[model samples]
Target: MTIQSDRARDALLDAAEELFARNGIDAVSNRRIVEHAGAANHSAIAYHFGGREGLLRALVERHHDEMARRRRELTEQLGETPNIHELVTTRLRPLIELLDSLPKPSWRAQFMSQISAVPSAVEVAKEVIGDADLPDDLRFINGAVDGIPEGVLRGRAYLLGSMVVGVCADQEAKMNEDANKGSWEQVGRFLIDAAAGMLGAPVTDPDGAVRYPSVPLL
Candidate 1:
C-alpha cells in the first residue's frame, strides 16, 4: 500500500511485539495491538497480517531473522574453527545488540521472559525458529569449538540461549539499576570473555564451576 500504510503496519508490529512480550501470544488481541500502535485503521492488523497468528509468526520471523543474521555474520568472521570464546562471542553479540537497540528494552525482555516460562509461547518461538531454515553456519561455528564435550553441547546451547534470553529479560534493567555502563558492544565482549572458559576449541571449563550455562534439556 502507501508509505503511510506501511508505517502503520510497522506500528502494528511494534505494538504486537510489545503486547506479546508483556502478556504473551495468547493474551494479545488485534484491537489492543492496533490501539497500542496508534493506527487510525482498526483493520490494520488484519490488512497487513492475516490475523494474530500471522502477526505472531511475523514477529518471531523478524526477531529470529535478526538473531540468525548476526549469528551467521559472527560465524563467518570466526572462520570454520572458532574457539570457545569466539563461539560464545558469536552467539552473544546479536542478543545484546538487539536488547541495546530497543527503545523500550523492557518490552523485549518481558517477551523473552515469557518464551522460557510460558509453554505455548515457547512452542511458538521454537516453531518459528525451526522454520527459519537457518544455514548450517551455526553448526559449523559450533563444530569448530572442540573444547566443550559433545554431550554438553546441547546443554551449553540451552544455557547460552538462556543467558542471552536473560540479558533481554530484565537483565539490562537490572544491570542499569546496578549502574552498569557500556552498550551492546561492551556487554557482548564481557559475555565472550566470561563464557569462553566454559566452551571452546580445546575446552577450558566444561563443568562450569564458576558460572551457569543455560543450555536446554535434551
Candidate 2:
C-alpha cells in the first residue's frame, strides 16, 4: 500500500475505534467513520478493509504481534514449572502493558469489551488470533493446573477474559474522568492475582461435591 493509503487506513481504524468505544459498535455507520477519518472517499473502509468484519479483524491483528512478543518474553522468564500466578501474569500483563503504552484517552480496551459482546465480531477477532492452535505457554499452563473440573476450568477461562476486558475498560474510562483512579500496573497486578485465585480455586458441583478435571488456561 502507498503511504497515503496507509495513512487513510490508520485514520479510519482510529476513528472507528473511538466511535465504537464511545457509541455502540452497531450504532456507528460506515459513512460516519469515513467522515470522522476525514477521508475524501466515502468507501475508504470497504476499499481498505473490505467491510466492518474485515475492519474489526484488522483492529485485532494490529496489536497481535506486539502482544504475542510481550507474552513470549514473560513466558521465557518462567521456571521449568511456573506456578499459577506466574502463568496468569504471562497471559495477561501484555494487555495491560499495551494499554499503558497507548496515548492517553485510548479506546482499545473499551473497543475490545464492545466487540466481546458481538458474536460475529468475536469470531472475527478469533479468526485474527488463530484460535485453532494454542500457544505453548498456554498449553503448558492448562496442563499444569490440576484438580479442577474441565467444565469449571473452561468456564473460569471465559470469565477471566471477560473480567480482564471489563475491568480494564472500566479503569480506562475512570482514568479519563480522573487520572488518580490507579495505574495500569496496579490493574495488571490485581488482575493477575484475581485470575490466579479464580483458576486455582477448587471446583465443586452444585451439590458441593468437589471435582477434579483439568481445565485450559487460556
Winning model by lDDT: 2
Clashes of 2: 1
Candidate 1: stretches off by over 4 Å: 104-106, 131-142, 145-147, 174-182, 200-218
Q: What lDDT score is found at residue 9 in candidate 1?
A: 78
lDDT on C-alpha atoms for all candidate structures: 0.63, 0.79
Worst 10 residues of 1 by lDDT: 209-218
TM-score of each: 0.73, 0.89
Off by over 4 Å in 2: 133-138, 206-218
- Per-residue lDDT tens digits for candidate 2, residues 64-142, read 7898898889989989988889988988988999999998888888888888666777677767776543444445667
| lDDT for residue 214 in candidate 1, whole number 0-100 | 29
